[model samples]
Target chain A: MQLHYGFDELKDIDFMAFIPIILPFFAVGILLVLIALIDLYRHRKTRKSLLMWTFIILFVNTLGPILYFVIGRKDSERL
Target chain B: MNKFIVLIKKEFVQMVRDFKVIWLPIVFIFLGITQPIVTHYLPSILGALGGGQGITIDPSMTAQKGGEVLASTLGSQFDQLGLMILAISMMGIIQTDKANGMLAFILTRPVTVISYIAGKIVSNYLIAAFSVAIGYFASYLYVNYLFTDVPFSHMITALVFYLVWVLFIVSFTTMISTIFNSQGIIALISIVFLIGCRIIVGLSTVIDFVNSASMSKHAMEVLITGSVNSKAIDNALVTLVWIVLILFVTNYWIANKKFNHE
Candidate 1:
C-alpha cells in the first residue's frame, strides 16, 4: 500500500512539537555511537576484538553502543 | 531484608556502571517514538524510498489510531529488538558471577538462595520495567499528539497485564542463565524459547493457554476494544506459575551445581 505525501504534508507536520519528541533520541543515538567509536579508537590496543567491535559500534544502530558497554571491552566484567 | 535490599542496590549500581541504566531507556524511547511517527509518516517514508518507482501508501495507515500505534510498538518493536536486547543485556545475570567465583563467594555468605535469586531478578526486572514504561509512555505521547487519545485507564489495564509477560521474560532469562554456562548460549536459549512461544501460540488453542504472547494481544484488546480476553489472562496466570517454577529450579541448581570457581 503506497500513499503519497507531497510538500503540503510538511506544512501539516508540527515540527515545533515533533522536534522535541524526536531530537533527544537522535542526539542520544548519535552521541552514544560517537562515544563508542572514541572508546573503540582509544582502547584499540586493549580491546579483545577491535575490528569487530568497531564495526559493531559503527554500523549497528543504538544496540552497538550497548553491546560495547555490555561485552566489547576486555575484562568488561570490571565495568 | 537489609541484605536483600543491599543486593538489589548492588545490581542497580552495576546497571548504572554498565551504562544500561543510562542507555536502555533512551534507546527504548527512541524505538517507541518511532512507531507513532513512522505509522503517521509512512506515506512520506514510502515516498522517499520510492525513488524512480511509483508508490502507494495505504490510506488506512495514514489515519492510524493511537491504540494501534501503541499496539504496534509492543507487537513489532518490542517483540523483535526489545527481547534481543533484554536477553543479550542479561546473559551474564548469573554466569558472570559463577565464572568469576563471585557466586560461590556469595553463596558462602549467610545469604539465602531465595534472596540471591530474587535480588538478581528483581533489580534487573526493575530496570526492564522502567525502560518499558519510558518507551510505552513516549509512544503514548506521540500517539496522543498525532492521533486520537486512547483511554488512560484502559491503557493502564493493558500495561499491567503486559508487565506480567515482561516479568516472565526477565525471570525466564535469569533461569536460563543458571542452566547455561555461556553468554552466547544463554542469549540463544532465552531468545529462541520466548520468541518460539509467541510464534507457536498461533497454531493451537492448547498452546494459547501456555503461551505468554497472547497477553500482548490481550493487552491491546483492552485498549482497542475495551474488552478483556479471559483466555489471555489465564495464560498470564499460567506464565506466572511457570515463572515461580523456573525460579525454584534455578535456586536449586545454583545451590548444587559445581562452579569452576575461577
Candidate 2:
C-alpha cells in the first residue's frame, strides 16, 4: 500500500523489503545474457554485432534487454 | 484446407530449424522469472544506492497478514509480461522473417496468403501463451516458497488474468508486424501505442469513449485485477478488431503483390 519509502527509514531497513523490488530486474538481466548467448551461437558469423548487443544489454539494464528485443535481434538483411 | 495445413507445417519446420525459436520460449520464461523478481527487489536496490538517504523497509509489517502482497507481486509480473516482452517478441518475429526474405520465399508456396499469415499468428500466440504460463508458475512457486501463509488461489487467479491480458499484447504486436516492415519502426510504433493507450485511458475522465478502446484501460481493470467489467470487454474487442484488420491488410498485400525472384 505504501509505495514510497522515506530516506530516514533506511537505518533500520529489513532485508525482506529489498527482495520483492530488486528480484525482477535481476532476473531480467540474467535472462538477457542467456538470450544473447543463444543469439551469438545461432549467428556465429555475426560475432561483432553479437558482441555489441552483449555490451548494450549488460550496461543498459531494463531498457537494454528491451532494445535488444526490438532493434538488436533484427537480421542484417532487415537493416 | 490442405494447402493451409501444409503451409502451417512448413512454417513450423522453419520455426523449429531456426535457433531463434529457442529464443521465443526462453524470452518468455526469462521475462516470467524476472517479472516478479524485479518487482520485488527494485525498491531495495534503489534504497541501497541512496545510502544514508535510503528508505527503510519493514518486511514483517509489509508482509504482515494479507493476500495483497501476492496480488501486487503478480500484478507487477503481468505488467512486464504484457508491456515489455509480448510486444517486443511479436515485432521481432515478423521483422526477422521479413528481413531474411523468408516472407518472400514463403509467399511463393502453394498456400494462400491468409493461411500463411494465419499459421504464423497461431504459432506466435501459442509461444506467447506458453511463456506467460511458465513465468506465472515460476512466480507463484517463488512466492509460495517465500511466504508460506499466502493463499495460492489468489496467485492462480492473477496468473489467469495476466495470461488473458498478454493475449491482447500478442495480437497487437502481430498486427503491427504485419503492417510495418522495419523492426526499429515497428518497435517504436508499438511502444508509442503501448504508452499512448495508457495515457488515453488515464485521461478518459476528460475524453469520453476514448478510454473504451484503450487496451491498458481494460487490461488493467479486468485482467490485472481479475474483474470482468464492460470496459474490459470493450478493450478485448478493440484488440480483436485491430488483429483482424491488420491480418486482412497483410494478406491482401501479399496476395496482390508480384515478386521478382533474382
DockQ of the candidate models in sequence = 0.35, 0.26
Q: Which stretches of candidate 2 lie over 4 Å from their true place?
A: A1-35, A47-50, A54-70, A76-79, B17-21, B33-82, B92-105, B147-164, B205-227, B258-262
Candidate 2, what DockQ? Answer: 0.26
Worst 10 residues of 2 chain B by lDDT: B208-217
TM-score per candidate: 0.88, 0.69
Q: Please provide TM-scores computed only on chain A for all of the candidate models, following their numbering.
A: 0.71, 0.61
What DockQ was computed for model 1?
A: 0.35
TM-score of chain A of 2: 0.61
lDDT of 2 by residue, B129-182 (tens): 776676556655555544444455545554554555456566667667766767
Write the residue-wise lDDT of candidate 1 on B24-64 in tens digits.
Answer: 78667877887887787667656656653556656778877
Best by TM-score: 1
TM-score of 1: 0.88
Candidate 1 lDDT over residue span A9-68, tens digit each = 545667787687667668878877876787667767667778888888888877788778
